[model samples]
Target: MKFATALLLIISYIAVASAHMAMLWPTPRGGFGTKQYNGRIHAFIGYKDNVWKVRFPCGGYAPGPITKMKAGQTINVRFYASGMRASDIKKQPVLTKSTKQFHQARHGGGMCEFSLSYDGGKTFHLIGRYTNTCPDAYFKWPVKIPSNVPSCTHDKCLFVWSWTANILPQYYMNCADIRLEGSKDGKLPSQSIQIVDFKNRKMNVKELGDGIKHRASTGPTKKEISGNLSGNIPKALKKA
Candidate 1:
């Protein structure tokens, strides 16, 4: 009789523990989310489905592929106040100094060196080097062209670069345009690289090549573009 009673107690304890764990750790809660506070924004990192949440205030969220995250993997949530604009919120700038830069060197119509800067152009850092054997020789977002040491005339060129920022913005709200530029002088141009900022429900496409464009809309007011590039790039680029 005593043995049966003890067994029942053990099973009861296990059942209670399982139920408690489930209530405390729900699945979708393991990912990432953002919030605003005290004239600044913050980011949180923890199991969207577990029992840990650390808040780090900064500019925006860059959701990554959830399928790539496995159990026990280390995740980082960072926040920066310098990336925010005046119209984002009624708050002061977090960082007094803000900047970012990217540079690429080409050889044989391909990228030979890549670097970037963020500290008001005071310093630069090497991000990568490239050649035919590199795995990212064909990735096409930040266009890569390969040709000569100072000339990009080759049909197959590669470009490499880094992205560094002294501080991230507080929020990326009301972004109206994005632009990119290429040159024959073998030097990186100084200008804003146009990107579609989705929050304000707006689209900004700057002239790059002769045949590049974009259009945007929502519900029944969607827009379209006619160029070599098709499909929705911004729709697939949202951070989780």
Candidate 2:
């Protein structure tokens, strides 16, 4: 009887902890969900109670193998479900039919942004943004790699997915290791970003949300945050 009770307690915890949304596509190396995806899968990939770990890709978990693709390709992201209901997960690992739908508010909503990285994680640039609009699950975000992007001189680049919640100060982040081959005569992008931390102010949350509100863009952003970043752009990007 005691062993059964202890097992019950453990399941209750996973249900509460996995409330944040998980990114499904351009498919992060890690993939999504605790046990719902195909092949080998892991637990939810959100910041949740561990909000401070936003800086670490995949919540500080070592990333998965590289996802290979070419330049100017359209990237798509999928989520298990949209905002789910509470009763959805009361059964714990028994996984009621609602487990996939358990990602409701507290499941964290608000904004999502996609970016690209070259030079072995030294610097990254903005590639796409989705604001005030991701549904509970399976959001297909098809973003095309700019025709002017440089090829993987080395073989690949990092694809990053960042989500900020509206109900709390949590930020969810994940990255897919990608091998990108861009056009030979590449033109650099206008704007790029390098997010390294998080804040708690209401203003900060709105600011973070607002930053990604604009439609996907190219070239330096109209709104720039000044920093002394030392990472340099490639010759093709510099000319852009």
Candidate 3:
């Protein structure tokens, strides 16, 4: 009886630990959950020194299949902020549930950003961002690719999704291997690709200890940069 009870306790702990958001579309570095490993769905959800989570890029996951995309295309990014159901992992694009219950796992709809990396996840360029009420009950969000973004091959390109919770200091990220189909190795000006820390709340780009500045190279004025709310986060998240 004691052995059976201990097994039950272990399973319960894993379920609670793994109850978090997951990237659904563009199919993150690792695919959705499995019967034996449901925690794989939340593999990229990071908190402080969680190693595979906030501390490492792509949650320390290796690259998966490459998705080919165009420079100026609108891609639908999907996420499951709500708790997962058995049916959620059975299909592609992840079917949305109509249930009315609010899952606190949504983290009160936090800020989300879409970025692209050309240097094997060393640096990222912000392409689009959404603040405040993001990733609500609605699971799908559309991200428009900027026209001037450069083309990249499979190994060098990564599409990254980052979120900072409004109710919790927790940070989450997922990366998808992608290749941009276009011509000419045109690079955007330094002002356009701001080098910011989408990593974890504990560390910034400079803290990586690589001596890389944590801001844009050319240093655009504060008025020019958009959707950056680094220091001023919601009070609830701070206290949490």
Best by lDDT: 3
lDDT of 2 by residue, 159-218 (tens): 877665444555566667777878878755666653423543233342122222212112
Clashes of each: 32, 15, 1
lDDT of each: 0.20, 0.46, 0.53
Count backbone clashes in candidate 1. Answer: 32
Residue 25 of model 1: what lDDT? 7
All predictions: root-mean-square deviation over Cα? 22.0, 11.2, 11.0
What ranges in model 1 sit over 4 Å off? 1-142, 146-185, 194-240
Query: CA lDDT of 84 in candidate 3?
Result: 37
Model 3: lDDT equals 0.53
Put the candidates in lDDT order, highest first: 3, 2, 1
**Candidate 1 at 16: error in angstroms?**
25
Model 3 lDDT at residue 193: 29
